[model samples]
Target: MINPLGRLLDENNYIVSDGAMATELEKRGVDTNSALWSAEALIKNPEAVIAVHRSYFEAGAAIATTDSYQATPQAFVEAGFTKAQGAQFITQSVQLAQAARDEYLANLPREERLAKGGALLIAGSVGPYGAYLADGSEYRGDYTLTDAQYRDFHRERMQLLADAGVDLFAFETMPNAAEVKALCGLLTDEFPGMTAWLSFSVGASSTALCDGTPLDAVATMANDCDQITAVGINCTAEENVTATLHTLTPLTAKPIIVYPNNGDIYNPIDKSWQANPNARSFAALAPEWRAAGASIIGGCCRSTPADIAGMATALAAQN
Candidate 1:
């Protein structure tokens, strides 16, 4: 049987996943400054949320990652919601993405899907524990949780989304090796019946994680975890992706998925992004990243639908 991620790659020369979620929402006039980020949109403007997913699919993203990146119950309760409410909100992310996919397909002609391998997929996003701190640590890899602590923090949400029926889980934007090891265990034992992918974030260099763990060493760490359907990078600089891929592609047989942030730089102290004026060039660079061995390609922070649409056009033209 084709592995889930393998099926996605087999269906096309390269699978184009959706672009930025939180930043895209901001462009549509949603204020994403709070700790909740895009998860805030789940409660305030769900149609706005569905619209983002639909826009990605219309622009040719075959995989629509859910807006649950920062939807942990612990964070929700910290923001004053009850445990049950947080769980419901987390589950809603899956439902909204599924609804968007159905709505998009209903208006499409059968031929486009017949040409591709299938309709769009929904990857339930699971952000790192640092995301819950809202201290900008997710990018810096400053987490200090134990293995059991990390697994406890993620298990409930993983179970919630898996039971909610997302096609796959995206353990996206992880920073440390310890958390990756713990998450791989959660996938194997806690959610043994589920499927997911693990992705790490890095700094300017490709040789090590943001926290200085050697990049390929982490991939080697999970070489035996069959449940991790794929492994790669996300929320990383566009410049660093290919170099990191060069380091990672040899460590594991799993497909390499790279969805980099626009060239803009995030300054944690200022809580501002020094915008990349050259982001328009991202589309032109997509092909090179694919050639570098990124089987799953997409955009990350600071990427808009227009950016993804342009990326879609570029990638399809190359094919």
Candidate 2:
């Protein structure tokens, strides 16, 4: 059973997903300091959110992850939105991405717009529970929550996103195997038609998850789940790219997805973001990433549209 994403890889060798939702939003003057992150734009500035997606599309992002990574009902309710409103906001996250795709397609030459293959896709983002806590615990993954508890925590938003209609799930920045296991189970049991891509954040050691679990063991867990269509790393420092890819590419037969951040560091505890002066050159590294077997690549935190466009242009030039 070939995943659709697999077909895209076969055709193009690599496809670009969008770069940094919150970081891009902040560039447009949206305040991302709240627990909601870019999810806030889904309510007060949906059109602004849509515009960002359009920017990425114009810049060559083939997939746009929704602006709902931090948009759980609990978070919204805690921020004073009602449960129903929270659900609508989640659904609207997909809507905004779709709107961007449609608008982008509409403007292309008819032949380009009507191309039978490689159309844009929307990935409903499912941020880990620790993301809601906003305490950087997502990078620690030492929570005592049971598997069922984790599943319970993710259920509502997952269902709403599925109902809203997305091409796949982007379980972004997961730090442990447990959350991956829990979400994979629920996808199998609940959203029968849905498949997901799981991207883990590498920990202090470049070869391990933030929880210190070896990528090999985690890759094994992900490989056993039929619901997961792809597996790789994201939101990790650019310096970790080579080791992370070396550890992962051999471990999974699935397509590799690697979207590393600029070497910037974020402290969820103090909500401070300091620049990593040592950040690697993202554009110069794309060829190596492709050579190393990353079939899907893009930028995460601090990666701009120009950065993604540069990668896309580079791939085009190679052909």
Candidate 3:
């Protein structure tokens, strides 16, 4: 059967699912602080991760990314592992994703498999490195590493994701052109068959990434990578996505995927994340996004399964 991710690469207007973040985990009683070092929970609570995947699938997600975004070498380092020790942590993270994929496949029905063509896709999520440039131009918020150091950090993580056998390599929340270029090249060289998808964060300029890289530059870089099948923006204000769609629509022929965050960031002081975009509002934007040439849709930070379900229904109605 053709892989679902491959099918997404071939088709237009696809719906990929986004995983729940710390907010959802908090609802599940996982303290945000503890989850940082809780690698064992991925295995011990496999059900939690699988349930989230299944939720998106039921919500009409044609693709599901693995819960491996924070499994980076730098993330491990921050959680108290040495550089060498961090390598093992990253490798183990990929293995967790592989296990999740295997279980997801086992749970699917063989009779419907032919029609679905193994509709499930395990996407390995690569986020920004633990560093930044002057003037807040880092892909990640850590703001401690330089561009060259970030490249090396991503190289090691890309190798781990490649070794994990994920069907696709997705770079999410990239703030700069340099790191995005390095990641796309690294994955293409190491995993020839794996597809690449990218999502850049909206910055102060609204169109430029946090690193001051323009949307067109990001799209151009992503398209130049032979393995990149899609490129778009994520992890920004919801309204910004609509603008981004317009900015990116005319730039390239690659399919676009978007998963914007709720309008406001969640700060303990504001507690404003508790008051933000609902599923209906997010799903309601699907048609607008699709018309603007965004073929793939999903949600990002602070978005839940219900939000994904709303999007699925909206897309189905359009089709």
TM-score of each: 0.95, 0.96, 0.82
Error of 1 at 254 (Å): 1.1
lDDT of 2 by residue, 75-153 (tens): 9999998999999999999998889898899899989998832568889999998889877878887776788998899
lDDT of 3 by residue, 1-319 (tens): 1234547546634665664554565566554444242243453454555556656665666666665665666665666768777676656655655555555556669776554555556677776663212122333343444555656777777777667666677788777677777777666666666677888877645567776667788788877876887788877767777778888878888778788875555442322355653434767887788888888788877778788888778878888
Higher-scoring candidate on lDDT, 1 or 3: 1
Q: What is the lDDT of residue 32 in candidate 3?
A: 45
Q: Write the per-residue lDDT of candidate 1 for residues 1-319, one digit (tens) a residue.
A: 1256777677677888899998878877888888898899988888888999999888888888999998999989988999999999999999999888888887777885466435478898999988888877878897788999999999999999989988889999888889988999888887777778888988888888788899777898667788777889999888888788888888888888888888898886656899777654668888888888887888898887777788888888888
In candidate 2, position 266 carries an lDDT of 76
Residue-pair clash count for candidate 3: 1
lDDT of model 1, residue 267: 82
Residue 270 in model 1: shift from native, Å? 3.5
Q: Which stretches of candidate 1 lie over 4 Å from their true place?
A: 113-117
For all the candidates, what are their Cα RMSDs to the real structure? 1.7, 1.6, 3.9
Q: Judge candidate 3 against the unseen true structure and give its global Cα lDDT, from 0 to 1.
A: 0.65
Q: Tell me the whole-model lDDT of each prediction, alpha carbons only.
A: 0.85, 0.85, 0.65
